[model samples]
Target: MITGASSGIGAAAARLFAAQGAAVVLMARREERLRALAAELTASGARALAVPGDVASEADAAHAVKVAVTEFGGLDCAFNNAGYATAGTPLHETDAAVYERTMDVNVRGVWNCMRHQIPAMVSRGGGSIVNTSSVAGTRATGASAAYVAAKHAVIGLTRAAAAEYGERGVRVNALVVGSTRTEMMEQVLRTAPELEDRFAADAIQKRMAAPVEVARAAAWLCGDGSSFVTGAAVPVDGGATAT
Candidate 1:
């Protein structure tokens, strides 16, 4: 199952996982995109389903998982990648509603997804979960205080969930992503094109990552390849944290 599967890393992960023979369930706010991707995957011989809804809604989260179980037989993995943020203006200058909105989608959204995903995984012997975080999850960046705080909370939640579910055959992990070329980064770049080079410089590799690059890490954590891995903040950043 993949939330935010309509685009970016979430969409990339769904494609990669389906190509690897895993039945994928796509979830996001855009029903058209989700159904379109599902059709494309099905055409390629993958079992796919589209469930469109907001991750912030617990009912939506739960329903997505249920569809995966009913259609694909059982839930094996999930990527909680739905998130939002407009800019990184200083906290004092930020609107209160913006802060709450960021928290609702980034933090509570992950919480909502895991609450249902874990049980579904447990019922089927075990599974893996990959939640999206950021370099801001570990260090201060140019983003707003709310985005940083909410991302940090994702790591906290991942660790706690990993500890509680490891013995139960479930592995929970997070991605400490950095300067990726996605809609999120595009939102920042559209206003300051010159900042693209600056963002690239922040990464030791001197370039933004393709969403597929991060999707590969997420796929590894979800598959048996990383069975021993849990509670990890795997960095998909182009060595952004190295600095």
Candidate 2:
């Protein structure tokens, strides 16, 4: 299952996971785009289903997982990638609603998904779960303070879940994502055009990642290839956090 699967890294992961022969359940607020992607994948002979809903809603999260188990038989993997960010605004100037929304989608979304997904995964004997964090998860990164805090919570949640469930055969990990050329990043760049150069330069590769780059890491983590990796904040950041 993948949240935020309508676009950006989530969409890329949905396509990649489906092509790799995984049954995918996509959850997102955009019903039209989600169903369109699911139809495209289904036409290509992949097992894909669209479950449109906000990840931040506990009931919606439960419903998505239930649909995944019903349609696909069981849940073996999940990419909890839905997130929200508001940059360029100083903390003092940032509205409380912005902070709440940021935390709701980024932190609480992952929490809600995991709360429901873990049981199905445990019943299956084992599973892999990948949560999306950010370079801001560890550093300020000039993003809004709310975004930074929320991402930090994501990493914490990933580690705690990994510890609690590893013995039960469920592995949890997070991606320390860098500046990527995703729709979200485009919005950030639009609001703070001057930060583009800085964003690129922050990475050792001197460029933002493509959505597929991050998606590949997620696929690797979710598959058996990374069987021994759990609770890791694996970097898909082109060395942005390496220094």
Candidate 3:
């Protein structure tokens, strides 16, 4: 199962996972796009189900998981990648609604997914969950303070869940993502075009990541190849965190 599967990194992950033979359940608010992607995958001979819903709502998250179990037989792994961010606003200038919405989609969304996903995973004896954090999760960045704090909370939730559920055979981890050429990043760059060079320079590779780059890392974490890895904030940041 994947949240935010309608576009960007989530959409890329959906395609990658489906191509690799996993029956994918996609959850995002964009019903048309979600169904289109599902149809595309199905046409390519892959199993895909589009469940259009917002991750911020507990009921929606629960329903997505239920669909995954019902259509695919059980939930084995999930990528809780839905997130909201607004940059360039200081905490004082940011409206309370912005802060609440940031926390709702980034932190609470992950919380809701894990709450429902873990049970199905436990029933099947094990599963993997990869939450999306950010470089802002570790330190101050150009993003708004609300975004920074919300991302940090994602990592905290990932670690806490990992520790609590490892014995139960569920592994939880997070990706410390760097500047990627996602739709969100593109929008940010469009607003402040000059930030493009600055964003690329932040990475040691001197370039932004493609969504598929991050999706590959997510796939690795979800597969048996990463069997012994858990509770890790693995970096897919093109060396941004290293600097």
Q: What residue pairs clash in candidate 2, if any at all?
A: none
Please, what are the lDDT tens digits per residue for candidate 2 over residues 134-226? 999999999999999999999999999999999999999999999999899899988999999999999999999999999999999998899
Best-fitting candidate, scored by lDDT: 2
TM-score of 2: 0.99
Order the candidates by TM-score, highest first — what do you get? Answer: 2, 3, 1
lDDT order of candidates, top first: 2, 3, 1
For model 2, the run of ten residues with the poorest summed lDDT: 83-92
Residues 1-243, candidate 1: write the lDDT tens digits.
899899898889889999999889999999998899999999999988999999989999999999988887889899999988767688999999999989999999999999999999999889999999999899888888999999999999999999999999999999999988888789878866767877789899999999999999999999888989999999988999887
lDDT of 1 at 241: 88
TM-score of each: 0.97, 0.99, 0.98
Which one is best on TM-score? 2
lDDT of 1: 0.92
Of models 1 and 2, which has the larger lDDT? 2
Candidate 2 displacement at residue 64 in angstroms: 0.6
lDDT of 3 at 164: 96
In model 3, the clashing pairs are none
